[model samples]
Target: MGILSRASYVIRSKVNAVLNRSEDPTETLDYSYEQLRDELQDVKQGIADLTTQKKRLQIQKRRLEENVEKHNDQARQAVEQDRDDLARQALEKKKQKMSQIEELEGQISQLQRQQDQLVEQKDELQRQIEQFRTKKETMKARHEAAKASARVNEAMTGAGDEMEDVSRAIERAEERTEDMEARAQAMDELRENGALENQLDDRSSLEKELDAVQQDGEVDAELDTLKSEMGKEEEPTANGGDEAAETELEQELEDDTVSDVEVDDSEVEAELDELKDEE
Candidate 1:
């Protein structure tokens, strides 16, 4: 083919492809149905016209028959009155009318045949159109059902464009959530290791150190108070009334001192463990 012909062919192919993509089967079927109905209407109109022509021909033939009967009467009267020329003229006119009637009958017969053929064709075309309409509706219903099923499948499988977009969005959200969790865990680790300080705290480093020293001094004072209370509870109240009692009191004081030392050490260890946990 020539370049122009090839170009035309390509254009036509592209147009057809576009049309196919854009065409709705339901709408196309309806359009075809309408076309068939319009054709049926045309055929009915044609039959009606043919019938009207036949009726006109029949009416003319009836008038010609009436004229022939009138001519016969006139010819009979003329013979009775001995007027043969008038009778002969009337007979000639009647013959002409009869000939015209025969022609009209032939035309009417032709019109009747055409009308009958057209009516038959119209009936056949209408039957085909009805069948097509039924098939078209069934096909349309199937097409609609298929479309609905396809949409449901696409949604379930996440295959459609909107579903894909939603899937991506969910993935992005999950990634962001994981990242935030990781960052929070890292921050907690840093805070626990004293690598990161609380931004909300207003105290300077020197002030914090001073506060720590003050807290330690308070703990030491509380420990001293506790030790004095224990010492008072363990002290013997006996006067130096007997040597045995005095010796026993000394022994008890020594044992109490050893127990107090052990308790003090335990209390100190517990305090240290608490401080470590807080840090």
Candidate 2:
């Protein structure tokens, strides 16, 4: 095809596609039904007009026939009275009326035929309108049902943008979780690689020595308090039997008392090891 022709064809196809998409099947059916009804109305109107003309012609023909009968009676009365000229005039007038009646009859016949044709056309149009209406209604219902199905399908399918947003959100959540996990692992590595040494690095040898001395003083004070409490519990009573009962109670209370002191021999050895390591 020529370029211009091809371009025109493309434009026409596009326009038709757009129109097809925009047009609703239900609305188109309704419009077609309305058009058929309008046509039916027009046919009925034509029948009415033809019937009116036929009635008018029938009335005219009837009047003309009455005048012809009146002329015939006048001719009979004139022959009896021997008035030939008047009778001839009456007959001539009667002939003219009969001619007019004949013309009117013809006109009435034509009108009747036209009325009959229009009536038949009106009936056919009515039948067609009814049939078309039924079809249109069916089409409309189907179109509505199809449209509802299409809407449901569209919702089920989901919009690309919403799906994309969900995907992006999931990706972001995964990325955030990975970042948190990496941070946690890194912290674990820092701890495993002796992060405590880094904190100790912030102190000078003099501060370490002072801290050990302070810790020793606190240990000594705690030990003195424990010893004083033990001495009070172990105080010799004036009675030997009371002293034996106190010794038995002291053995039972040792576990409880030591739990509060928190300064076991292992802890003391660990403190000594820390001091040596620092040196």
Candidate 3:
């Protein structure tokens, strides 16, 4: 083919493909049904027109028949009155009327035949349209059911855009939830490890250490106060025993001092001589 012819063919094929894709069977069927109805209406109109023409012809034929009868009566009268020329003229006019009536009858017959054919065609077309309507409705119902089933299948298989979007949303939500959970767990771990204390607390590390030392000091001071309080509580119970032991020690010391004084002089002289000899 020439380039122009090939281009035209390609264009036509593309247009046909587009039309096929865009065409709905239900819509096509409805359009065809409407076209049939319009054709039927046209056929009926034609039949009506044909019938009208036939009626006009019939009326004209009736008038011609009446004229023929009037001419025949006039011819008889003319013969009774001895007017042969007038009779001949009247007869000639009657013959022309008869010829016109015959022609009108033929035309009427032809119109009747056309009307009859059109009526039959109209009836057949109507019947076909009715049958097509029934089939179209049945096919449309089946198509709708199939379309709904296909949509459901696409949703179930996550093949549809909306279903795919939902799947993606769920995945995103899961990812976000997992990330949040991981972040929360990490925060908990950091808190447990005391690594987040500086971030969470308003204190510097040095300040925190100072606070800890202060707390320890306060605890030690409180411990010392408790020890002092306990010792004070026990001191009253031990004071009487301490005073009795002190009196017993003082009595023993006085008795030993009196005995030492009684032996000192004699013992001193004798001890000095014994000490010198032993040396």
Candidate 4:
């Protein structure tokens, strides 16, 4: 195809596409039905006009025929009365009336043919219009139903799209929440490890620190009582061990008899005094 031809074809296609997209089948059918009804009305009106004209022509022909009969009677009476010229004039008028009647008859016949054709046409047109109306209504109903179904389908599609988006959004939200929780847990673990290293010398040290911070005077009082009781338990055992050691040493010294040896009175007196001082 030529460039211009291709361009025209493309333009026509676009126009057709626009028209098809914009067209409503139900409205088109209704408009076509209205047009058919209007045509039917025109046909009916034409038939009525033709019938009216035919009737008028028939009336005119009847009057002319009556005049022709009257003229014939006048001619006969004039001929019987021996007035040939009047008879000729009467015959001439009758001929003229006959011609008028003949013309009226022709007009009436033509009008009758036209009226008959118009009636036939009207009937056929009416039948066609009725058939078209039925079909139009059927088509319009179907179109309306289809349009409603399409609207329902569109709504369902929109809902489906929204639901799909919502589902994805929920999934994304859940993922974010999970990531946030994981991050929070990781930070908490790091904080716990760091705090344990710096503050909690041992596992129980954290508990001891917490208890110390939280304790009232009652805990200190209880600790004091426990320390006093431990002191009392150690005091008896320490004093008893020292006393038993002194007694054992005294027995051992008494059991040992001094070696028999000549000694001076002064030395003996000094030794005895020392022993007394030691006791």
State TM-scores per candidate. 0.66, 0.58, 0.73, 0.57
Q: How well is each residue in 1-279 modelled by candidate 2, as lDDT tens digits? A: 999999999999999999998998888888888888888888888888888888888888888899999999998889889999989988999999999998898888888888888888888888888898888888888888987897777667755566668878999999999999999998889889855355647887788789999999999887777668557544557888878887988987997776765568998899999867755
The regions of model 1 sitting more than 4 angstroms off are 1-7, 141-166, 218-279
For candidate 3, what is the TM-score? Answer: 0.73
Per-residue lDDT for 1-279 in model 3, tens only? Answer: 999999999999999999999999989888988998899899989988898888888888988999999999999999999999989999999999999988888888888888889989999998998998899899999999999999999988999999999999999999999999999999999989987775557877899899999999999887677657556533453677878986998999888877754567878899899856755
User: For candidate 4, lDDT tens digit of each residue in 78-116?
Assistant: 999999999999999999999888888888888888888
Ranking by TM-score: 3, 1, 2, 4
| Residue lDDT tens for model 1, 198-276 | 8899999999999999999999887677657557444565666656786888999999887754357888899999867
List residue ranges in candidate 4 displaced over 4 A: 159-279
TM-score of 4: 0.57
Where is model 4 poorest over a 10-residue stretch in terms of lDDT? 194-203
Cα deviation of 66 in candidate 3 (Å)?
1.0
Best by lDDT: 1
Of 1 and 3, the candidate ahead on lDDT is 1
| Model 1 residue 69 CA deviation in Å | 2.1
Stretches of candidate 2 exceeding 4 Å from the true structure: 1-8, 159-279
- 266 in model 2: Cα distance from truth in Å? 39
lDDT of 1 at 15: 100
RMSD to native, candidate 3: 22.4
Task: Give candidate 4's error at residue 206 in angstroms.
Answer: 32
